[model samples]
Target: MADIEFPSVEWFQALADITKEDPTYRKFGRLNAVIVFKCGDKHISTNFDVLNIHEIREVGENARRDADFVIEMEPDVWRGMLDDIKKNGHASLDWTLNTLDLRFDEPIHRNELQDGFKADMFFRYNPSLQAFFDNAAKIPTKFVAPVA
Candidate 1:
């Protein structure tokens, strides 16, 4: 297991590698879009197009992009989700990705597609995403400095 930090290139690469091998991920079809992960003052933007998952690019101090989703949360929350993945091979109640994002005090950005068609991708291909993160269960993770 790899000790990964949120907003780090290594973490995103790990997820990409895992997703590529997951059968469920292939079922999700091709997805092309970028997702920005922001925690406190640190920001990392990752691009996922087709089956390619790029490294996390530091975009500190830059304006946000027009992305499919913008996932923002406290550093501790991110660590908790990874910890949950490590324990259960999947995120549970308090650490479910969607649940965490929804519970965040700040706004979570998503495409304005009608009826949340864009957001539905998470549900439609949940098994794949779950499998992707489940790989984390096998890897060691290092906690980043938490925000208050």
Candidate 2:
């Protein structure tokens, strides 16, 4: 169990460690994309390539760049997902990563070419990502204090 916060280098490292051991993740046919997460003033970015996660970088501020996906949310929403992951061995219907992103009314950023390709990866390797996050159930987390 880990006491890491969401959108932190430690959190990303923990996820990467879990994913490395997942056979399902290995079957994903090599994913190479950058995912950026933003919440209030916190920003974290990670690069995944060849099914290997690398470069878990913490940035002081959001920068303009092309990414496969850019997830922006309130810190509380992010904490809820982590708590759900801890409880259910996976995110629940309302907390699923994709679902959470869709629930946001504003437009999210994604590079059409890269993101479109990643969408294919999602369909092709849905189970793997599911399994990857499912491993979160084994990790302990502290929910971030919600900002008003």
Candidate 3:
């Protein structure tokens, strides 16, 4: 298996690729939203069109202004959650996106950029989004070294 770096477009693409081929990812129905994931200063955005992830790219900090919403957290927190997913084949109860969003420790902040209408997509497609991330377990990933 090839090792892909986390928080990179390549890594996110791997996830999208895997999910595209899985019938399970299709059951949630079509999703139409632009979700930006932020780790510290890095911003990666993915556009979900119909039933597939159409694009994944690294965007500038200004991406949030265009996204329906942004999910922000420290890289360490992301790594921790990824590690947990890898170990369990999927996120455990505590590491699930909803669970992490609820926890005080390194909580995943959902910053709504638009009105409640657009921001509601995150919840409307929560199962699909969670399944998208769960596909990460299918890829072997390497964490980029943290800068001092």
Candidate 4:
């Protein structure tokens, strides 16, 4: 299979496919949340429903407001995390989303509606979210070039 470009629908879909087969993911139990990824100018959303990833697609800028929470990060940070995942079969403790949230000054876990309860979903279901992205290690992924 060709290397899927990161931050694209195809790339995310590939990850979702792998996540579906992972029994550990199911063990983490069900989660219903619309999580948005803010990578540079891209707005990618994934709806996690009933223990499976229901949908993953690019969305309009304003569409992020509809998600339960948004993880806003620079494109480079995402690349770094993926690279680590590929090398180690998963993100190292430091590169995990939970760790990143604490390391960065900008809140990666956020609620567009300013609902604290919704924002906490990122943590509540963190193990599942970590497992979802960890599957990226199983895929051949190519990072997109940075904008000049």
TM-scores for every predicted model: 0.74, 0.76, 0.91, 0.95
Cα lDDT listed for each candidate: 0.65, 0.66, 0.82, 0.88
Q: Give the CA lDDT, 0 to 100, for residue 82 in model 2.
A: 72
Across 1-148, the per-residue lDDT of candidate 2 in tens digits comes to 5477655678768988988878767865676667666766766777777777878787644342555665567777767777788887778898876676578785334443555665454445456556666777766665555333
**lDDT for 2 (candidate 3):** 82
Segments in model 4 whose C-alpha atoms lie over 4 Å from true places: 146-148
TM-score of 2: 0.76
Tell me which residue pairs clash in candidate 2: none
Which residue ranges in model 1 land beyond 4 Å of their true spot? Answer: 105-107, 110-130, 146-148
Higher-ranked by lDDT: 1 or 4 = 4
Model with the higher lDDT, candidate 1 or 3: 3
* Per-candidate clashes, comma-separated: 4, 0, 0, 0
lDDT of 3 by residue, 36-93 (tens): 9987677889998898786799998776888887888678879988998899988889
Best candidate according to TM-score: 4
Candidate 2 residue 102 Cα shift, in angstroms, is 2.8
Query: For residues 36-147, could you state the per-residue lDDT of candidate 1 as single tens digits?
Result: 6677777667776776667557675343444455566677777778878888887887776656657767434444332366556556545555566667776667766834
- Ranking the candidates on TM-score from highest down gives 4, 3, 2, 1
